[model samples]
Target: MGSKINDKRESLWQDRDVRFDVPLNELKLRNGERIVEYFSKIEDTKGNAGEEGKVTITNLRLIWQSKIKPRINLSVGLGCVSSLTNRTIHTKLRGKHEALYIMTKVNGTRYEFIFTQLDLELGTQFGIVQLISKVCRAYTSTKLFRDLKLRSAVITPNSKQLKVLSSETIYNKIDGVWNLSSDQGNLGTMHLTSVRVVWHANMNELFNISLPYIQISNIKVRESKFGVALVIESTDSSGGYVLGFRIDPSDRMNAVYSELINLFTIHSTKPDLGVDSYLEMGSSLAFNDHESNAALITTSDSDLKEIDDQHVAHQSDAIAAYLADEAQSKNNEIVYCPQLGLAIEKIKEGFTLESLWQVIPQG
Candidate 1:
């Protein structure tokens, strides 16, 4: 129960949000991070002419490194990326060709980067722009995993033909639903998408609520001034909103309520947080540091075995590296766990509650 989302901005930016001048040796997949796609023969237009670099799009961030000098690199987290666009910009590599423009804000400071396609044969059927756009969309849709949002524009604007999420499908829709948040309830259409329950005001589309099933603490039919209204209670982190809605025809309302309950139950079993990633059949998780093999290359069985061994060692190293960084930065403090209702140590990559318990001296 809170006011509509305002323009008040709050930042969660950290020192680790963006990194530059990264060493190529340090480029390894951390826990819960996977390479979605890789593009080579890409020119950093802002840099020198004919200076090509490789771009790796991961589940968490975008990494770009110079082909000739691997030490020159940039890593931008998706959390800080405000916009990604395709625009024609003048570059020494290719004159006035369409390039990928990324705008990001880290710690209240804005940064812009432009990268152009150097290899013409690497055309549009499956290009850098398309891949990055798809990955960015995947990240945006899966915000429930990161943080709680209220009255956000997470839904498609189309009212008639609602756009289904890549990992979600339409369940049902109820029209002529009245939201009882205001003194005079606003009539809107309620959509029961597989991922969330969305209700948008018919008059003002801006006034809407996208309650993801992950944040729903409870949903039941309750008696209110509107009489026989459906109530939804959100989790504490999500402002603990208790939303009420009314639908005409009592039986139909009951039916919709029952359907919602069933859908929530089914989704709870294996909830899709909207993260979609796919690596080709023979691709390796490791980044090939060789300049000659800048383009996408498939790995053989023998190569896979070698890569697996390296990956395990790299994962262990990565954990230690993160711990060292956390200690130096002094930012890894215990935070509140909304789900557990307790303040616990913030577990970094390659860590779990059980592992921490085993390591700690329990009295």
Candidate 2:
């Protein structure tokens, strides 16, 4: 029966290729895996910073193919992705464009896919972001279900109540180095579920901590002397204490913050309120009055002569210089609400949690 079901799923996957121009072989899908969602005009962060492309999210991985000449291809395993969130970008002709940011677990590499040259209808980008988030959550849940072991065969009544929202193998920075050696920081698995966030050290199960969302008053990401860290402020019967966990690869920090915020909002008393205020906050952060200085591309006389000789050096140099400057500037600027940090602040300000659910696209 399982084999028959798998065959049916494969057939269904093949049938869904009516919209895609690329062949299935090019996608290189694994057995029983299928593409769930795809979008055009997706700009990759690599190379030109905004290289136009098409991105497809499958059960196994995200595959992106560049639309420009000398096509660039890349794929990221779903298991490696920490989070997917919506980002707003300012473009020269387009004014403002909504982009999808994919943060990975390794070295916190962030890939931005911008929706350019495409007319996005109302709520389109929101739907896309929500779909991506759901997919990531599903992958994380599946992984946790497989890896976490239990001693007893019988399940407790409360076992079903704990729904894993997100799980990842995170290294808790004890020392500055994450070498996985005995003297280095401990490595462990972290899970954010319906009730609380749990971290169990791989070396010792007893060395663990669980913090309920209700008790959490504040959660912030800041640059510390050790590096980027997630500081969770909570209050208990004994009083208040801050729990700090250093997440390496730094980029994955936002995703962790966003997941906690999402779970917290879901468990709030009133989940259907505060949509407008959250949108207002996001817009306020996105609005930048100062226009960025555009780069001037001037061709020297020798370069023009080289161009006549069909030499590509001049064009390559110009592109390389522009990209370097763009990267440097981005590194210098502070990211706004890297995760749902802003949303958490609004929640503390007495705003209800309605907007978050409304903004994120559901499966």
Candidate 3:
């Protein structure tokens, strides 16, 4: 029986052509945690020239095992990771190499880890980074709730509450920013979850804003003289306030708006479904209707008729142009152009109207 087991192990090693110091099953995992991906020959930024290892990313933690002599093992819990940043490094001989910088918290102390020479496509790296960031955000949010003793602050229908969907750094414009410096806005981190949008200012730990999705009546992206702004209209007990955030990169503002819209839609339709189930159902529904109206909008009218003989292509562009023209006439009215997701607010004094356009989903 011993000889038979040894022979089986040798055969398995020969088939795979690689030895794993720590197998996937051997790694410690929390309940519901699972491995997401594995990458080989990843070098730690602080290690020796020839030091390389295999890196494994689980839903709960990141594990690394050195491949060379003096084997080293390291693990970072996802809950401890604060952020992931990607950068390009230029070497005299190696030219340009992509690197990933991971910021984590250990025993309340912040640490940074850099991994170089990652053999991943740009798109794949981006997707993986985004997934890791999302997991970390959810973990951090749970930790925050626990630390603040506000686990019951969010009133959910079920036990599953405070599932973070996305989080990003944004600037909150001060009311009197026009009279202040250009960089006068408060820098803060924003977290969007299934239930609420939370903002924590870097300078003010005691001051934070949390607004539930139910209170948010409308969300709009607008152009300001200084930069792009996210306009959130809420009807909460504070007598309802319009909050504006000036987000950098403009694209992030759009993403936040889209996420809010999705949350609003899901909350309105399926309030009972938990975040995980809600996401799964949304994916299934989207996959099943792959050739729905959204697909038609992307293809040209001629191609649309060729693909679906029963369907006639609508002149969406023409309608958009007409809407734009009509909006120009109504200078006093704040019109929301469906074609362009912008709220056409009247240009107030001391503000310059910039020609910015973005495509919005057809209502």
Ranking by TM-score: 1, 2, 3
Error of 2 at 291 (Å): 47
Q: Specify the highest-lDDT model's number.
A: 1
lDDT of 3 by residue, 274-309 (tens): 222322332331112222322211112232224232
Residues 1-363 of candidate 1: C-alpha lDDT, one tens digit per residue: 222222122222211377665434345544335556677778766543467888877766787777665545667787777766666555443666767767677666666677888786865445776666666666776675434455566555664445555556877878999999988899998989777888888877668877777667778887888788888887665678899999989888888888888887776655545554222223232333334443332212232333345545644543233221323336666889786799976765434454333321121
Cα lDDT of model 2 by residue, 1-363, tens digit: 001011111211221121111332445543334455566656554334556666666555666665553223455666556445465556664456665655454333333333333446533443556656765655554432222232222112343222333322222323221212233456665667554566656545455555555445667776555556677655442136565666666667666666777676664432211111222332331211111200010112232232232225433442343222335434453434645555233232212344334344444
- Cα-based lDDT for every prediction: 0.63, 0.44, 0.44
- Superposition TM-score, candidate 2 onto the true structure: 0.36
Give me the runs in candidate 2 sitting further than 4 Å from their true place. Answer: 1-26, 49-51, 68-70, 107-117, 121-126, 144-363
Model 1 off-target regions past 4 Å? 1-137, 141-160, 277-363
RMSD of 1: 18.0
Error of 3 at 285 (Å): 15
